[model samples]
Target: MLGFLTARQAGVDDPLRLRRVESTRRVLSLKLNPDRDVDRIHGNGINTIDIEAVEGRYMLSGGADGVIVIYDLENFGGKQQYTCKAVSTVGSRHVHKFSVETVQWYPYDTGMFISSSFDKTMKVWDTETLKVMKVPDRLLPSALSLPLSFSLFSASCVLTFPCHKVPYGHRAEVLSVRWSPRYEHILASASADSQVKVWDVRRASCSLLTLDQHNGDKSKASSEAVNTAHNGRVNGLCFSGDGLYLLTTGTDDRMRLWNSATGENTLVNYGKVCNESRKRLQFTVSRGCSPEFVFVPCGSSVAVYALHTGQLVTMLRGHYNNVDCCEFHPDYQELYSGGKDCNILAWVPVLRASDVEEESDRCGRTALVNPAFQDAWSSDED
Candidate 1:
């Protein structure tokens, strides 16, 4: 890092290249931040958490106690102790009748936010007034799955409506709701009734497509609404960073991938992902990294899997109880997971290249030297 800056001070023309290399190296050296704490504000176990995509400086957390909190993740207090302090919150005094299942900030702005709860209602809020903007009649939580929340922030279509059809929206409780990253008007949902449905919210009267497990088997698709998504309940749903593919996890103990466009099951087999919780199982995919990964909250640990290929990468073990949700920090390649233990764990990639290189030097293994590492040692200045 010093060499990169010194080269700039000395008027080297290629300093940007060195700076980018240094940034990637720092991200690869992620470690658990022992100095920072979550500031234990939630009286009960936290169910869902989201760091605003607009600016990663703040985060929103909703607890099982029907409480909502906004925390300042950055160390702006000027005190070195650096505990994340809650800026504002809506506690038991709020309108939510049951556990607050999920909380999120507007994707493009911070002045507004949304929360979903077990009480069969999802509400919008004005951050300035800290008052309920609109409590819609959505989020009728699943009989077997937890609640879902995503910011479809525009004032137009709130996921406030249940997907049912006779009228064909979700006949059962919508377990998960995610706005399509590619098209702002497109939304996808998973439900307790074992179905994954896509909605082009521009027309609330109908959905774009319904995913069938049979993947075009007329025998099953033709059955009376028997084209269930999973053998059991579909409790989790997430879109790949590019929004080109969708992923779902269910109580059937399996994870499946799909092409978001045509709603075809790509069937990239993620074998037996044990999910016992009847609540929303939140998971996230890594963005802006080579070999993207998916982080899912497993039993007492978070499971890391190679996206698109169902290979198990590693189990991030730390939490002592059932893990419920995990979110990825794309800016730093960090992972934050919350669980029944009432603890939030940060999984980080320890700087291992130096250790591996040392061992390789002792073993006289030339192949261990990656081209990037070899370049780091050989500089134009050298």
Candidate 2:
């Protein structure tokens, strides 16, 4: 970090260097945050979580019991015992016929959110009224709304499109849905049918491209016309932070990366990515770091892998049951994961070696105390 300051002082214009240094420091510091606590709000397994892209002060979480919770992450109490409180909730009796598969805040505003579920529906909610507004069959609405991406399935859906309506579509349950990070009209979906299809929602007639295991090349295994991304259920879909590449994982115990623009399977071979998840397994990518990493929920743990090469880096093992989702907070290089155990664990970077020694030397010979941040810079958030 000191070297980054020195480089800036020398008038060097390398943002990549700064990012790499910062990312490494942040990744190394990651340890379970014990000083703070998130209120135990979910009565069932937590399925999905999303931090608002605006202020980053609030976080939204959805659970298998059809519950939606909003947590205030701000440390207003200014102490270690401070607990993140649930500012609001949308309970099970009101909406969603089944488990909420995903929950996300509007990209540009906190006034709205989008969620999907196992009930074959997706709903857009007005945060102020706690009422949902119906849009087109497309999960998001309008031209600019294209970038406001989140989750896919829901039971009581507003943006309803039946299977028979499309010319060509998957023959099984659409487990996951994601909007292209780069293209406004492009949408991606994974299914129990083991295929990944990209659709241009504007036309809504047919998918632009159907991804294949052989990268559209005709092989003895299958023909080009019949494209299958995986031999098993594809449950997870995520685009890279920069939107250049798309990453997918399946029940086949494999992970594949693809070219988003052309829908060509890059076949990066993330070997044996054990996934027994019948529903969507939410994962995320790290940004501002060269050789960025992909974080995936691997049953009882969150597995960190080198994005390009597919090498397993480390496993985050705080969860007692199968972990369903993990979200990366790039602001402070932190991670928050949810699982079937019904726990939300916060992972923040551990203090530096020198900083630890400094604190320990100051304390005494008895206990080596880990430090907590006070007056932490929440200003850079979002």
Candidate 3:
């Protein structure tokens, strides 16, 4: 029966069979969004999803309910939908009192992971033990007494390991945090107080540079101490592929690019794009090529833009609800996007020669009477 189907469906043309096989390979080889509707496990929505940098075989997801799950992407059990069995959990009882804001694997290892929470603490957990690996110290400064009135302030150092913990800078809740892809010792963070900070994990002194809204002039250099590129809360930040540039998005309905080394704003404007508002609008940079592109999570669709020019090239539309995050697959020219709709969509470029030929033929001129040909045949004018 199998032999008959192969002969009848594939026919005798070897070339056609080969092309059909290649097309199927490309489609199936693309990654899936992994929208596991396992509400039975975690009652709330997923807040973060991260793919392992080295193997790309496993994925990590953190939910609003403070549940962390590890998913195996490879299908080995011959199942229709790739089953993502939960490897371990922190449990709902001991989970973060607030939402789990971020989840990231150790840059160099697979047995450890880090997660941050609105509870005002970041925890590094041993993936094998499912327990906290390191917990840094905390410090609170004395209340300042002003001439007119007294203002209160407190400081805490969240747990970050493989480095000393003396003074973790943010005085308020940390909104977003990321490790440097190149230098593992360097970490960057954004806060609710409208500040961006760079920290060297080696020392806990003051932040390397405090990005504030007021430097000098609001239009020129921020009049404040830290540079404030966004008029509202700067919720999202990402380093460019080459680590030369940093991209930021805010509630101001705009995206801006900056020189990471000099802390200078590039001022590339993305006009009136609605952000996730409350959640972090994660963005990713495409690797390779002369001109690189940034994939930004804009409302219901993902916007692809040129890095330096800030020109809007194209918009990918498929999500029924607002898109929360997106990442570019470096191995293939494919895109993986996920949203509030609880579904992930994989987009592959359609590049068949026959498809292009059909489009060209449809637009080609069919009229036989050519103006140039008629003009040449006309009798000589007086």
The TM-scores of all predictions, comma-separated, are 0.77, 0.84, 0.66
How many steric overlaps are in each model, in order?
Answer: 9, 8, 13
lDDT of 3 by residue, 1-382 (tens): 2333355466743444333333322322233334332223455655566666667666676667777777665557776445456566676456577767577776457787777666656667788888887543431111111001100111224422233655445545455666555555655666555667776656636667665433345576644544555677667878886677777778878777767776667766667767755656667777652245678888788887657767664677877878777766555545666566755466654535564344223222211232221211222221
| lDDT per residue as tens, model 2, 1-382 | 4556666667773656666656744654467788877888998999999988788788889999999888988888778667888899999866588898888887889998887776766678888888888666664346334575555543212223444564366777677778877876777888877888887777735677778778645654453356888889999999998788888899999999998888887867677888999988899998766557788999899888768767665788888999999898887778889999988888887776785444334322221221121111111222
Ranking by TM-score: 2, 1, 3
Model 2 scores worst on lDDT over the 10 consecutive residues at: 370-379
TM-score of 1: 0.77
Worst 10 residues of 1 by lDDT: 139-148
Candidate 3 lDDT for residue 345: 62
Better of 1 and 2 by lDDT: 2
Ranking by lDDT: 2, 1, 3
Clashing pairs in 1: 146-279, 146-280, 163-169, 163-170, 164-168, 164-169, 164-170, 165-168, 165-169
lDDT of 3 at 264: 69
- Candidate 2 vs candidate 3, lDDT winner: 2
The Cα local distance difference test for each model comes to 0.71, 0.76, 0.58
